[model samples]
Target: MGEPAPLAVAYDEGAVSPAEIAVGVAGLAPVAFVLPHSPHVRKLRPVLSRLGRVVQLTGRPERDAVLLRRLAPAGVLTFSESLLRVTAGLARTLGLPHHTPEVAEVLTDKYRQRERLAAAGVDTVRCRPVPDVAAWEAALSAVGLPAVVKPVHGQGSRGTFAVHDRADADRVRSRLFDGPEDTWVVEELLRGRPSGPFGDYVSVETATGPDGTEVLAVTGKHPLTPPFRETGQFWPAALPHEDREAVSDLAVRAVTALGVTTGVCHTEVKLTPGGPRIIEVNGRLGGHLNELSRRACGVDLVRVAALLALGAPPPPAPAPPGRVYFQFNGLAPVRPGRLRALTGGDEIRRLEGITGHRPYVRPGDDLPGGVGSVFMDLLTGDAPDHPAMVELLDRALPLLRYEFTDGATTWVESPRRAC
Candidate 1:
C-alpha cells in the first residue's frame, strides 16, 4: 500500500481510472492496465509515470501469448469479457486471477444466463436465444407481445429495442443486417406500473470468496420506463426494505450460479407481479453508477475486486447517505440543427433536488452518433422533489431553442435566395 506495485496491462494513462481508486484502496501499486487491441484501450492509449506498463499485442494468438509473457505482472483486469476467453492461458501463465474464459462467456450470454438461473430454480424472466427472423417470430409467438428483444451478448443500452407490436419490432429492426452472431433473445415481459416507486433498477453489487458472494451494496437504477434504455442511476435504492432484500437475494444467487469471483456488475431486474425478476448480468463495474458509488458510498469497487481477486478481505463499504444521478439530456432530436439557447442549465443546476450532472450534448455541437456506450449504469441519485424536479426540468428544457445561424431572415432565405 506504500507505493504502487509493478502492474501490467494496457490502458490510457492520461485518463482518470479506477486504477487510481484501486491503488488508493489496496495500498498496492497502480495496475498496468493493458490493451491488446485497437478498439480495446485505444482512446486511453497513453500510460506513463511508473503507474503501470502497457503491452501492445499483435492480432495473433501466438503473438499475444508471447507478448504477455514478456510483460508479466502480478494482476490483470479488463472490461472486455472476451479478453478472458482470448487469453486465459496467458493470464494463468502470468499467475493472474483473471476470470476464466468460460466464466466470461456464461455471464455475457443471455441464453446461458436464463438457462442456468431457471435450472437453479431462481426467479428470472423466461429467456431464449433468438438468431433471425424465423427464430425471432417463433420466440415472440411463444413469449407473446410486449416481449423484450435484445442482443444475446450485448451490453447495457446497446442493440436493445422493445417490440410493443409487430410495427415497433419492424421499425427498429428494418435496417439490421446479419453480422457477428447477430442473434437475440425473447423474454417474458414482466409488467411494472409506469408510475410505481419500484420502477428503478436495483443492481446487486457484491464480491465473492471461498464460501460465496458478499452483498456489498444495492445501487438503484434511476431512469424508469423502457425500450429498456437508461438515462441515469443512484445508490440506496428508493425501494422499501422488503423489496430491497428480495432483489439482493436474487443477485447473490445469480452471481454465485454464474461463477463471478469479483468486480462490480450491473445486474438487471424488473419488479414484477410475482417479485424481482432478473433480466441479465455482466462481469464488470457499473458505469456511471460505480463512480457515484465511490463518491457516495465510499466503497471503491476496483479495490474490492482486487482484494477478492488477490484473496484478501474487502474493505468496509462506505455508508454516506450520498445520492448520485446521471445528468440526462432532455429528449431532443438525433440530427444537428441550430439550438436557440440553454435555458435550463442554470435553473436545473440551481434546483434543490439536483446532485451532479455530465451533459453529453451542448447547444451548438452535433450529438454523437445519436447515442452510444453504457454497459451497466445504475447510479441515479435521489429525486425527493419529484413534482418540483419535473416542473423545473420542464421549464429548464425548453428554455433553450434552436434556429439557423443566419437568423430568422436566413431560414426563409434558404432556396428563396432573396435575403
Candidate 2:
C-alpha cells in the first residue's frame, strides 16, 4: 500500500547523469541522491530535487551517514570511482548490500589492486609506487623501461604516460612531480599484438549478485593515441570464441580476487601476446559504453545497476548483439589553447552509419589538453559488422575541423590531423 523505499545513490559526476539514473529506475523504486557540496553538484540540486530527495554531504562521513540514515533507504550505491570508499563506508554503516570498504579501497587504488591480483594469483605484474619525486627512480628501476606511469588514483587517463627509455621517464617525472603533491605508480607495460583490426585491449562488463557473477558484454576499444588516450569503443568485440572466453574468464577472476561479490564491475583487460592481463578493475559502470550496450543489445546497464543495488536478482545474460554499435570521441588537441571555431559537423552527420553528433566544447572555451579529453566531439552510430564500423569511423572522423589559438598563433586541425 505504501511506496517502495528509495535507493540512496552516492551521486557525483560519473558515467551516468542524475537524470539518466532517475529515468532508469522509474516505476521500479524511488531514488534519494546523496551529493557532495560542490559548485557542479549544486547546479544539479534543482534537477535532482524534481526526481527525488537530495541529501548534501558535509564532507564528514559520520555526520553524513547519520543524515543519510534518516532516509531509511533500501540500498546504497554510487557510480563514481571517487565516491566508492565513502559510499561503501556509508553502506556498511547502514547495513546495506554493497562493496565492503576494503574492496572499494582496492578498486580505487591502482597499485593496491595490482598487489591484490598478484597475491591472489589472478595475474602478476610488477608495479612500484612513486609517492613523491624522491621515489621515482626506485620505482622506475623496479618496473624497468617500456612501462606505464600513471596516477595512483585517477581515471580517464588524466595523468598517465608511457616510458620507453630514460628520456621519457625524465619527462614524466618533471611534468608530474615538479608541480603538485600527487602520488603515481610505474608498471611494466603489457605488450599487445603488433597489429589487429581491433585495439589490443577490451573491457568486460559484468553484473554480480546472489546468483553469482555474469559477464554482460565484452566491449572493444579503438587504438590509443600516444600515451593511452581513447578514441572509441564498440560492443561485441569481434573476437574468436576462444579469445572472448579468455578475456571474459580473466575478468571474472580479477573481479572475484578484488572481493566484489555484488553489483556491477567494469574490468579493463589488455590482450597481450602472452595472454590476457588485467589493466584495472573499476567498481562502477564504464563511461559511454552504456549507450552502446542499450543499442547493440537490449540491456540498459544503468537500470541493471540500480536494480542490483536494491537487492534484485541479476537479469539474464544479454543476447549477443545483432550489429556493431559504436561511440567515438574525437579527442581535443594535446595542447592548451582556446577554441575559435569548429566546422563540418553537418557533413559528419550525413556520413553513412553515423546517427548522432554532439560537440562538448563551444568556441572560446579553454581546451586543456594532455589528458584523454573527449570533450571535443562525440559521435554514435551502428554498422552491420566490425569492419564496416571501423570503415565508417575512418570516413566520418576526418570531416570535423577544429580551429584553436594558443596566445599568438592559431591553427586548424581535423580528427585525422595531430594537434
TM-score of each: 0.78, 0.96
Off by over 4 Å in 1: 1-5, 9-26, 47-51, 80-90, 169-173, 178-181, 193-200, 320-347, 350-355, 361-419
User: Model 1: per-residue lDDT, tens digit, 1-419?
Assistant: 54445445334321136455445444655555556565536655553334445566676777776777765555655545445455444555566775566777777778887888887777656676777766766787787778776777666455666678889767756633354647778777777534343344567776665545667777655454245555444556667789878988888888877777655555776766667878777776555444665566565566665555555654555564633333333333333234434343454456565554444444465333222232111112234443433444344434333332323331211100000
Local accuracy of candidate 2 as per-residue lDDT tens digits, 93-205: 99888999999999999999999999999999999999988998899888888999888888888778899988887788889775453888899998887546678889999
Give RMSD to native, each candidate: 6.7, 1.7
lDDT of each: 0.56, 0.86
Candidate 2 weakest ten by summed lDDT: 410-419
Index of the highest-lDDT prediction: 2
